[model samples]
Structure formats: structure tokens, C-alpha cells
Target chain A: MLKKPRNGNSAQHKYPHVGRTVSLASLSAHLGLSKASISRVLNGAPAARSIPQVTQDRILAAAQALNYRPNLLARSLRRGQSMTVGVLVPELSEGYATLVLAGLEETLSAAGYAMMLVTHHHQEAKLTDLHRIVMERAVDGIVAVDTSLPVIHSTPTVTISCPDPHDGVTNILLDHDRAAELALSHLYALGHRQIAIIKGQPFSSDTDIRWRSIQIAATRLGLSLHPKLVVQMKENLATDEPGFLAAQRLLATGIAFTAIFAFNDVSAIGAIRALQAARRQVPEHVSVVGFDDVTLAAYHRPALTTVRQPLRHMGALAAQSLLHSFTSGGNHEASHSVVVEPLFVLRNSTAQSPALSLQC
Target chain B: MLKKPRNGNSAQHKYPHVGRTVSLASLSAHLGLSKASISRVLNGAPAARSIPQVTQDRILAAAQALNYRPNLLARSLRRGQSMTVGVLVPELSEGYATLVLAGLEETLSAAGYAMMLVTHHHQEAKLTDLHRIVMERAVDGIVAVDTSLPVIHSTPTVTISCPDPHDGVTNILLDHDRAAELALSHLYALGHRQIAIIKGQPFSSDTDIRWRSIQIAATRLGLSLHPKLVVQMKENLATDEPGFLAAQRLLATGIAFTAIFAFNDVSAIGAIRALQAARRQVPEHVSVVGFDDVTLAAYHRPALTTVRQPLRHMGALAAQSLLHSFTSGGNHEASHSVVVEPLFVLRNSTAQSPALSLQC
Candidate 1:
């Protein structure tokens, strides 16, 4: 039922003389109504239905006339639920975290929940302090993105791309095994036998599992994993400098490889730059495949062929799961993990191997 | 001088018997101290120094032992000030807003403040609702990024990249005039006579002023901005598609131009893709310069030569100004605007103009 005004303008125009400082007590006094009766009507409590229609209308009219804005903080204090969630990310400048955050924010906002965001910058001490702060502020739940949070608490929690499993916390993860098979099978079908790999930074939660998946996939394809052909990204940089350096190191090894599978799109772009600098044209000499088809992948010069992780969708799923848990009264038995699939995106970066064509 | 334990482990180990539900009253009862005395000591109020060291130590020890966690929300309600700031941005996936948010979070977190982030998604109705939600949540202040908020309110507010001048809001802006001069002057010194320009999307706050500055800069350089050579981006996409489409439109005009100045790095990349598809090599047939040296700019295929806006620093400055306003009791008179300079970044995308060299 359209009981309230359609827009704020009509209410303000009709009550132009109402002051901003009007309180519930003053409104009750002016209407000659009990404070409890007025509160029940204004809050739309179940008991408000028992009140006569005329009295309810009178209470609503008086509230509109007095311009009594409810103090959400004080009300939340009495209710013991802040209706806010805390989000912790490693950093916000990168593509992965930001994309996930965008999806998370969209869903949370639609559900009428505010988000308190804090970046720990991958510092354990800072994470602990921020967690304490958010908990002190009394958020109803928490969403940790690409962060390791081991402590179990009463707050409903969801973790995205977080490898660590904790009791009473739900995890949103990507299908790393399928991701590996998709990338390796594509490269193998392209007639590339000698392939180099770039591993993610050690600090990344996905690094260990992703590398393990890659090794298993390579073995299943009957491809020998050469130590000299693999290099790991050493720095925790937001830019592609680490990838550029890793590719440079691969070239310096004087090893021959027709294809390079990079850790992410940013690093793939960097590796291509290093290949170009070394006079090896992309696809013409060294075909590169990247992971996580970030927004830049499609616009890149060679148009990076990548494995898409559906990052934003994963973020939205995390938010929905967290909200669901709130309604289910912390029922952690239903699901512990939600795994999302990865798809291979074919772009301009990959082509038939130079060596295979030469053999033909 | 260290009143608290260095780490959470020591306190937990020393107080393992304490229950998690302990409160201030329970701690006072356990220690036979008054609630006022315990609160003053725990909160470090000015009157705490007047209490004897023995009594203060007793209060701290018992509070820690009892696991008394002060409810920040309840305390904030009593103090009438929540140490939380509200941040509104158009979207979170883009580089500009995310970078600024990173800087803002760093500064705000360091000052023991939490941030409530909401994305309006460029919808006026959603923005209005979100604004009301954040305000009702009782944030101490607000920071709006690239958003138009003209409403005059009692809350302390700071805006970044907002062109609209509100009566009581402080604006953190990039010097668009200098930005135009930096890009145009660089192209002019390179002897580019016929240059095409890509204007930002209309929804962008910097689009109008930036285009105006470009026109003024072009006139100062004695260069004519032909309508055929100027194209404005139409779509509000997060990728480089709009820039690519704009560049394609420019090419379809069949006008001869030796250089192109794009709105941003993302669009510049798209424009480069379009030019490459048309067989015009970057810096060979045409020199292309981008704006806002995003993280990808340094790693782009041609390594975009662009203008840097220092977005992160601008975000940090906005946060500091908002904090300063709170400390100064909302003194908006001191500074209405904070203008930041732009720098010209030289890279491989731009070089000596092809037409000028041909003429020579």
C-alpha cells in the first residue's frame, strides 16, 4: 500500500515550517499520543496493525509534520544489529579486488546494507587491528577478499579467493583445476610443446594451489615440466613490472619456448612487452596466454587470450551468501564452499607454434 | 609508556579464564572500582591522570582480565560522533575511482577512522537513497568522488574531481588547464600540426572543463581544432571500447592528421587498436598521447605517453581535508578548492610528427 508520500519533495513542501531538530518525544507531545503508540506506528511494528486506521493516519501525519528523522545508531543499539557489513581487501588499485568489490557493493547496497571497507595492505598486524575495529563497530557480517583471516567469531563471515579454511566461515573460490586444464589444453592444441610458465607471487592466496594444478595438468598432457623454463614473480607489485622481470629472466636463460602462460592479464601484457623488446614478436614467435581476463585484456595490442574467472560474479555470490547466513541464523552446515568455474577466452595473443610450422 | 600489551596473544594467554561477554559493569564489579573510574582509565580521559597510578593499574588489569570490550556504537551514540566517514563514488571497477579510494582509505585508516563506501552507479534516485542511508548511519563526514552533490547540509563534506561548486563543500580538483597545456604543449613542441582529439564522456565531471581547457590551449598554440578532427566519447563503458569506436569515427572522416590526443589511457589503448587495424602504426604514421597515466599506461604495448593526474595523492588530500574540517569544527571558509598539478609523461607512443618529418 502506498501509505507514504511518493517523493521527499511533497512531504517537505507540506511541512515547510517543521524544524530539523524535531524529536519523537516532541512529536508525541504535540499529537497528544503515548510514546509507545507513536513509536509502533512510525516503526511499522506488528503491533501497529492493532491501532485504529484513524490513529495510525494521525501518527503518520504528525511525524511528517514534525520531520522526525529516526536516529539509526540509537535504534540499532536497541535492536543489537547494525545492518552494516565490513569488507577487508589487500588493496583496491588492482583489477581483481576492485572488480569483486564492485559486485559486492552492488548487491549489498540493493539489500540496504552499508559497507565499512578497510585495506590491510597484506600486513598481518594491520589486518588484526582493522578486524578488531570493524568488530568493535558491530558489523552484522564481514567479507574478506584475497585476505587470510583464521580467527573464528560470532559474526557471519564470507571469504573470496581466500584459500585458508576456517570453522563457521563460508569460502567463495575459483575452480583452479579446471582453469589449469583449459589453459594447458588450448596451448597443447596450438602445437606448442615447449612452454614457459610464470607463477604468481608467493604471498598471493591462489599461488600455491594454481601452480599445483598447472603441474598436474602438464603431467596429464605428457609434457615434461622443465625447471629452467619456469620463473616465479617475486615482488608484490600492483603493476606488471614483476612479470616483465620474470620474462626477462626466462629469455636470459637462453631456453627456447614457443608459448608462455602468464599468471594474470597484467603480467601477460608485461611478458609481451619483454618479448617485443627482445625482438620476438607476439604470436609470430612467442604466443602468450594470460589468466583472469581483466578489462584491459580485450583492448591490449595482441588482445590477450586468457582464462576468465568471473570475478565480479564471485563477489556478488559472496555477498548473497553472507546475507543468506544472517537470515538462516548462522546455519554453517549447509555449504562450506562455493566454487565458480573458469572459461578460456580466445583472443589474438595465441597462434600456431613457430617451431611446428617450421617442421611442417 | 606502553599502557597496553604489545600483542593480542599476551593478553589472551594471561586472561584465558575471561568470558567474551564481559561488560564495563562486570569489570567494575569484579575489581570493586566505580564504572566512571574504569571508563576514564580505559578511555584515557583527561581526568584519568588525576587518578592514582595504583587505581589505574587495577582498572586496566581487571578490564583486560574480564575481556571487557567497549561497545563503540553505544559509546559513539553517547558522544554524538561516530568515527566513520561515508564515501560515495560513481563506480568501483574503474582505475580513477579505485586509485583515489586506495589513497583515501590509507589516510583514514591511519587516523583510526572507518569508511562506509557506497556506489551510486550514476543513477540519481539510487544516489539520493544511498545518501540518505549513509547520513542516517551517522557518519562523522562525507567524501564524494566525481559526483555532483549540491545540497547544503550541516555535515562536513569533501569532494574530489567534482566540478560543481557547492556552498559549504571543499573541492579537490586536478588543474585541467595545466593538464591541457601539458598534453597540447608537448604535442606542439613535437611539430604536430594536424592533431585529432578525443573528448571524455559527457557524464564525467572533468569532461566539460577539460575540453574547454583544451580549446583554450589549442588557440594559444595557434592550432585550429577542426570539428572533423574532434570526437567525443559517448558510452559510459569501463573498457576501451568507446575510445576505439571514437577513433574509428575519426578515421571514417578521412581527415589527415599526424597525431591523436585521447581522453584517457584506456581510450588511448582502444584508439591504438583501431589505428593498428587500419594499418597506421603508432608513432610511425601517427603519434598518440593518452591522459591519466593509469597503472596500465606504463605497461601498454607502445607504453603510453600521457598526462599524469596523481589520482592517489588527490584522494589522500581529500581525506586529510575532511579530517581537518572535523578538527576545525567545520571551518569551510579557509579553503574552497585544492588544485593539484599535472605532469607530462614521455613514452614510446608519441614521437616526432610524421608529416613534419616528411616535410623536412
Candidate 2:
């Protein structure tokens, strides 16, 4: 039951000047009524006990002058569902992550879901805590954007990897094999048969599937996949020194390749550096292509022509799938994979294979 | 009773090594035991029925050789706590966010907290859904990273922008103003008076704090500040078009300034591009400095010398704060801000103002 309006009919006192003014706060203060009480009456908080007719009239008049609105959070709590979805990312400060997250956020928000973001770079260290957040039904569902997941769980998870799915988990992936294919095929079509691939790294614990796919694709391409061309980087972070070093080794081997496809854009950039240092003009002496088409790709000196992944679209789909599963009540056991394709982004970085050393 | 050894006093002739060498599946097949039952006994799961002494021996023998472990989820659930945190970000598929996240991941993993990341870029739309996820208590705590928040809650929030400590939130900021001071001072010391600044769009949301700081510092240094030096940008993504346009405008202004302080590494790179296009040699014709030292800043043709923020460290620290408060059982109510200072990294991007072309 709502409490009776304080000070009986004081609020109803005819204004000293008709319709001149009396702010809600002033009226409440003079009548000794709590702001909460005034707020409730104005916003129509559902309670049975009615305010005196005169007090109600006065409150309405005062509210008209003040033009106050109820707190969004308070109003939302009563609506049965908050239109917000908590987006948990390992980190948003990075470029690649930001792009994908941006895509997801744009789609979700347009559809009317607010994204509440929380980043725990220490999800492994505090699995118990993370699990509580994911499993206890706090969020409608979860999207685990862990590139190198040190851990996976039995809860409803949407994984971004190379096509591995679980019962309650949905996997969305940009086909690594196809991405590699796109790069390799482009170089092959440039009328060059000898192409070198510098694998990024083998240290990503969750990258076994990608490595495996590359191996298979290389075999199918019929290119003599030299173990040497597969220069595996042990370092996780891309460094110019190693890139130069790798290039030096590749050049010294006299492989006679006109194009180099580094695993990712950074590596490709590094390879370009090596090519420049060796006095090899890009697309003239050698052509290079990269993967991921990150923001830096376009901004780079020659601009990178590479493969594009629908990272943002994929992010949106992940959210949509989760929301669908969530709103449907029971588990949508059709757990499967959403594979995004990579498109070759033509840019200054690549050109038709240069006239092979005519001396050959 | 330790369930007396199954074959008590029967160490006679059946001392076969087969039992010890048996695989889990083999043992299960031999004993006709349910895989679940076998797993439970092997993993030390509490089972309803007491294992007969004979069955126990077989299970123990099979376990000792195979080295089976218990399901982590089941074990963690039993313990009633998870050591995980929910991290929410705008996205993780971008460079800056990824790099910073990498740093955070390294630190957080070292300390033992798994990061479960979620991505949400739409600012105004999905907030309600976000609230539900938080209220439902998905993870132990949350880290909001690189997300441009439209509205902040009283919840434990750590903002990326310039956070006012008065708001009772933890904000980690790179001393943009101080870094500007350091860059300008270095240039001043180098015997150059004329300067320019390539401002970032949203370089300062409400007011350009960095610009203001630069003005104040320059004024103190007795160096005249030019209004032309202050270029403002207001956009969401770093599309490079706006940056390029601004640089063109600055160049057209024709006021010869020795150094340009870009708000971020991307803008600085853009400034360099414009300088190059205009045939101005970097550091020779104009010495350039940028802020938010990004990965490309290092590989940038003229390695960029800019301010480096402890981005990853800040992420880890944010996670640590959440864990610290969570386990503290609600006593550490002190919502304080943690500010990480930026460092001036000198590189090939800057040089003494080129000997002014004496128009003699």
C-alpha cells in the first residue's frame, strides 16, 4: 500500500498566482514530502493507496512544470527484460578485436540490444569466477572471443575457431584452409608457380586445426611445399628483426619464388620490409599478400592487398545465434559451425607475377 | 574397513601383468562397468554404491597406468567458486585492442585468472541486455576495455577516456598532457620554436584536453601557439580519409612548423603520409611525433617516437582490481582510480627543426 500524501491537502492550496509557478522540488520541500514519494506519484509507481485528490492535482501541476522523467534503470527492471547483452571480450584495445567487436556491436545495437562489455584477460586464472558469470544465467548467453583459449567449458559457448563444435556450443570460423587457398591461388594465378608461404607461428595452443588445414591445402595445391618455405615463427608478437631474418634465409635459399604469402598482415608487412632492404621492389621483383585485412593493411606504405574476413558480420551472427537460443527457452541443440569466407582484396601490394628473371 | 583386498590370501597364481597394463577402455570392457562409473572411480568422484574390493583393484590398477584426470568443471562446481572474470570490450579483432589484450592476457594468465571476453560495439542500443547479464552475475567481475561508453553505471566501471576521479570510477589514463609536454619540451630544447599538432577526432570529447595542455605548456615555455596547429577530428573509426584531409589542410596553411604532435599513432602515420606526398622529408624538413605509441609506430619507416601507454598492464590491473574486490567479501568499497603514466619513446620520427631556410 502506498503511504498517504504527507501534510494532507497543503499541495492543493490555490497558487498565490494562477499557473505562475511551483517547482516539484519546491512543492515537495514545502510540504515535507520525500522526493521518492513525489517521484512515485508522478511516474505512477504501482501502489494501491491513492494520494488525496487535491494533492494528486497539485503533484500533477508541479510535475508539468518540472518535466522530470523516471530513471531508466528503475523503469527497465520492471519491464521483464533489459535490452542489454553483456559482451565479454578478452580485450577491446587491440585492432583486430576492435573490428570484430565493432561489427557485432553495430548489428546488436541496431536490433535494440545494448552491449555491456567486460574484459577479463585472466579468464583462465579465475575459471571458477568466470564460470559463475557464464553459467548462472546472468547474460542471456555467452560469446567467448578467446583466440587462444587456455580453457573451454560445458556451458553454452560460441567458439571462433577452425570448425570445432560442441553440444551446447556454436562455432563460427573464417575457413583457414580457404583463406590460405585464396592467397595461394591468387599468387598461382599471377602466372608464378613458385610461391613461398611463411607460417605465422605454432605457439597458439588452439591453432592445431589451422596448421593441419594449411598442411592439407599445400598438398592439394601440387606446389612443392618446401619445409623451408614453411618458416614457422616461434615468437607470438611480430618483430621486424625476425621477419628480416626469415626473408634473408628465404632469399639465400635461391627458391626463385616471385611471391610471398605470409600467414597474416603483420608478417606480410615484415616480409615487405625484408624485400625492400634486399633492394627487391614490391610486385616487380616480388609480390606479397596477407590475411585478416586489418585496418593497418590499408594504411601501410604500399597498402596491403589481402584476404578479407567478415569479422564484424561473424560477431553479429554469434550474438544473434545466442539470443535466439536464449529466447527460445530450451537448448537449440542444432550446434554447428558458421564459416565466413575470405575475399581477395586487390591493392598495390600485389601485381601479375613479374617477368621471371629472363636469364632463366 | 578398506574393503578388504578382493583376493585376500589369494596371491597365488593369478599375478598377471595384464591388469596393470590395461587401458581404461580395456578395463571397462573387461569389468563390464559403465564408462561413467569407471570415470567416477578413476577421477575420485563420490559414487553412491561402495565399490567391491575386486572392482576397486581393477579401477585403481587401470588408473595408475593411464593417468586419467577428473573433469575440471565438475570439480570446480563442487568447490562452489570459479576463478574467472568477464571482460567486455568494443572488439578484440583490431590491432590496438589485440596488442593491449595480449599484454593483459600474459599478465593475467601468469597470475591465474582466465579472461572470458565479449564484444559489443553498439553504444546506445544493447545496454538493457547488458544490465541483465551483469545482474544475473555471469562472471565474478568485469573489465570494460576500449569501449566508448555512452553512459556509465555506478557499477564497478573502469573507463578508457579521461575519467574524473570525482565520479568514483577507476580510470587508467596515459598522461596525454604530460606526454605532450615531454614532446614539445624535447623539440624546444632542439632549438625549434614553430610547431604544429595533428589532433585526433575525439582527441578530446567535450574539450581537447591534450590541446589545452599543450597550449598551457607552450605558453609557459614562452613559445607562441598557433591556432592552425590545433586540428580537430570527430569520428568513430580511423578511416584515414579525415586524417589525410586534415594534413592536407595543415600543409596548405603554409605556416612552416618544425614539429607536429599527432594525437595517436594512426594520425601520426597519416601526418607522415601527407608530409611525404608534399615532398617534405621526415625529420629533415619536419620532425614528427605521435601519441599512443602503437605497434606500427615501431615498424613505421621512420620509427615513430611517441608516448607509450601501459595498455596491457592497465588491463591486467583492471582484472586484478575486480578479483581483489570480489574475494575481499565486499569490504574494499573504496572505488579508486588507477592512473598509468605514459613514457616518451624516442625514435627516428623526430629531429631538430631543420635549419630555417633563411629567405636571403
Model 2, A1-360: lDDT tens per residue? Answer: 011133464543553333222344565776577666676677676751476767766777766665433332333323424455545555444345566667666666566565544455434554344444443322334566644444444334566552345566677887778877777777777765667777655543324565566667667777666666667655544454555666777888876778887766767788898899889988787888877787767767678888887777788888777667556643547767878787889888887777544635
Off by over 4 Å in 1: A1-21, A251-256, A275-281, A355-360, B1-20, B252-256, B276-281, B357-360
> How high is each candidate's interface RMSD, in Å?
7.7, 13.1
Residue-by-residue lDDT tens digits, candidate 2, B5-98: 2445453246543223233455577668877778777766668257776777787776665543333233333343344445565544444566
Q: Which lDDT value does model 1 have at B212? A: 93
Worst 10 residues of 1 chain B by lDDT: B1-10
lDDT string for model 1 (A1-360, tens) is: 001223456675675543244567778889998889988999899999899999999989888876666777777777778889999999986689889998898898889888999988787898888888888888889999988884756678999988777877889999999999999999999999999999998878888889999999999999877799999999878887898999999999998999999999999988998999999999989999999988778767788999999999998999999899888867657439999999999999999999988998
For residue A161, model 1's alpha carbon misses the true position, in angstroms, by 1.5
As a whole number from 0 to 100, the lDDT of residue B346 in candidate 1 is 97
Tens digits of lDDT, candidate 1, B1-360: 001223456776675543244668778778888888889999999989899999888888887776567888778877778899999999986678988998999899889888999988777887787887887787889999988874645678889988787877889998989999888889999999899999988878888889999999999999998889999999978888999999999999999998999999999998998999999999888889999888778767788999999999998999999899888867658439999999989999998888787888
The residue-level lDDT of candidate 1 at A272 comes to 92
Each model's fraction of native contacts: 0.57, 0.17
Predicted model with the maximum TM-score:
1
What would the DockQ be for model 2? 0.10
